[model samples]
Target: MSGYLMSPRQFSALKTGLFLLCLVPLANLVYGLLSDTLGANPIEALTRGLGDWTLRFLLITLAVTPLRRLSGLNWLLKLRRMLGLFTFFYALLHFASYVWLDQFFDWAAIWKDIVKRPFITVGFASLLLLTPLAATSTNAMIKRLGGRRWQLLHRAVYAIGLFAVLHYWWMVKKDITQPAIYAVLLTLLLGLRVYWMLRRAGAR
Candidate 1:
């Protein structure tokens, strides 16, 4: 089916709805942590769970473009920014939890851990890369950067995705099924990007 563009009002409504939808996971995590429902090593569980959702949203946001093109629903573009920002939001929480709860706000120790641990290094890199994208995600910045340049700059999201997947894969000790799934999904997303790029080149 062809996808119609949503009206501004419709888009606003969807944004509000999605904002509430995103809160569910955070709420559950908080409830689980406060009530002591998270089994053995609550902090670790919370960290992993939040990180997982961050990556999940990142992938989901990336998928939106391909899905829109394939399904002929252009309105999907309106949701990508919100999803991407939510991904960053969760990532921030995940990193904060590690810094505050896990490391007791020890900057030196955190830096040491990042240098020493490959997973932390990858995760930290992913966050660092996302920082600028988040910061520049505004209408004025888009205008200032120009469409082509802004798009090129935002391509760092792909690197963020790779780093996120690597971080997860490296963190797992034995049961690698979850990380493997994310890896496969990320591969598909990247593959779609390549295909779309080639398709555009052919059209040009």
Candidate 2:
């Protein structure tokens, strides 16, 4: 942990604040559900709400390395594990809402949706990619897999992000503006990594 960012107390407080902020959306969902205030389409609202947070957390997790690189706040990396887990958490809720509320756990219909629907296929693939990352995000798993192999497995996160954006884009048939914005943001993030990679290769 770099001593440059803030005192230990302040750092802990920052994490606490971020943790509560992340929970706000889930809390709002619960409140709306209990009050019957999620408009006429509660299932759609719940699913979309969960997807929004999943994307937000994914982007935030991706931002951590760049943030630490630019700002030199090395401790920022510590937050990535929590943020990554939250990404998977919301993703699980998104899939669960679809299966339980939308399809009523009808395996046939769900399988048809996964196979037939482009958006669902992309979303499901992203979830599958994320599962191993979330499951192995422990010190034990790290030691077992070894750092090099663990990093190779986790690199699928970039592909997950791409699949997620594609899933959203394919889902929204009418308005592409929102999806476009996320795509552009993700492209910029990818571009930054590519730029640094080429620079490093050139240096070598």
Candidate 3:
């Protein structure tokens, strides 16, 4: 498959297919919500589900760089932006569910919870970091910020990844298996970044 070379049109079609594939799980969540099939506590289920997808998509988006470098498939970079945006999309839904369904737009209560709950605090911080990345994802912003500065700003995704994993690890009471897996992947991704940075510095 490494030898397989797709034309530009084929590459575009492949990307469309992958994007639709990513949407299936999110669509299932919506279907589940509409049918009232979100387990015992609907709010908890929705929150967990969206949070899970957010982390999953984050991991997927992070994996793109390593995968592209290792596999020599430059096309992977094309999907990263869409995947990152989807991560933010699910995160927004997760936040909305918490504010609307759990806290009912109670600012005071939300503020109190953020201070008291480490998981919530980490999650909120991660979302805050993601906001600017999402906002500046356009070509105009890239041109305005310039490539180097834009790249530096987007590196906040690393911090977002850390906070996300911490949020998951802190939130889970007894079952730590899933969070641990995400932690391992996050570690690998960050480690790769460190390795690349050091290699580039050495080359200089």
Candidate 4:
């Protein structure tokens, strides 16, 4: 294999490792439940934990392109789809926790919360946007959609990321430190992409 690429076996190994690594957060949460270590507000802890992992995976998915460009590691692109799928998986879990555990399947109350709560509104919107992305993540869908259209659809991730940050920020009423950090990191990531676009346009 070239320096910029990985051998097939190595790639398979790395992909498996990453898949398992991504499950660690979920595993830890499960362990906490079994051990009764989630404290007084276990449901809230579980819901927030899944949501945090969802945002983290989303940010990590966004970072793949930058990392690949910076490190000249084209293999990183191979991992991106998997990372994106994981992001959606955790996002689904997060939403499920809220709808089931937190809201107790109360559709009327859920609708009310979504309508009245800014954070819930954005969080729901984020999940709605992620649904199509997750559904069409397959190679077959990409082939059917064609590369250009698929790329356009996937660009919604940027908006999803923005909504996710807003969801986190607005949900926290006190000690906005963590949400503020997420905001700064997301700004830098999106800003880097903007800078690159202008640079390319200037070169052209």
Which candidate, 2 or 4, has the higher lDDT?
4
Model 4 stretches with alpha carbons more than 4 Å out: 1-3
TM-score of 1: 0.94
Residue-level lDDT of model 1, residues 1-204, one tens digit each, is 347667778878988998899888999999999999999999998988899899989999999998988888888887888899999999999999899888999999999989999999999999999999999999999999999999999999999999999999999999999999999999999998898889999999
**Model 3 deviation from native, Cα RMSD in Å:** 2.1
| Higher-scoring candidate on lDDT, 1 or 4 | 4
Clashes of 4: 0
Candidate 2 — worst ten consecutive residues by lDDT sum?
1-10
Predicted candidate 3 versus true structure: per-residue lDDT over 1-204, tens digit per residue: 463488879988998998899888879988998999998898888888999999999999999999898899877887888998999999999999899998899999999989999999999999999999999998899999999999999999999999999999999999999999999999999899899999999999
Candidate 1 collision pairs: none
- Per-residue lDDT of model 4, residues 27-92, tens digit only: 999899789999999999999999999999999999998887788888899899999999999999
Among these predictions, the greatest TM-score belongs to: 4
lDDT of 1: 0.92
> Candidate 1, after superposition: displacement of residue 65 in Å?
0.3
Report the number of clashing residue pairs per model. 0, 0, 0, 0
Tell me which of candidates 2 and 3 scores higher on TM-score: 2
Model 2's TM-score against the true structure: 0.95
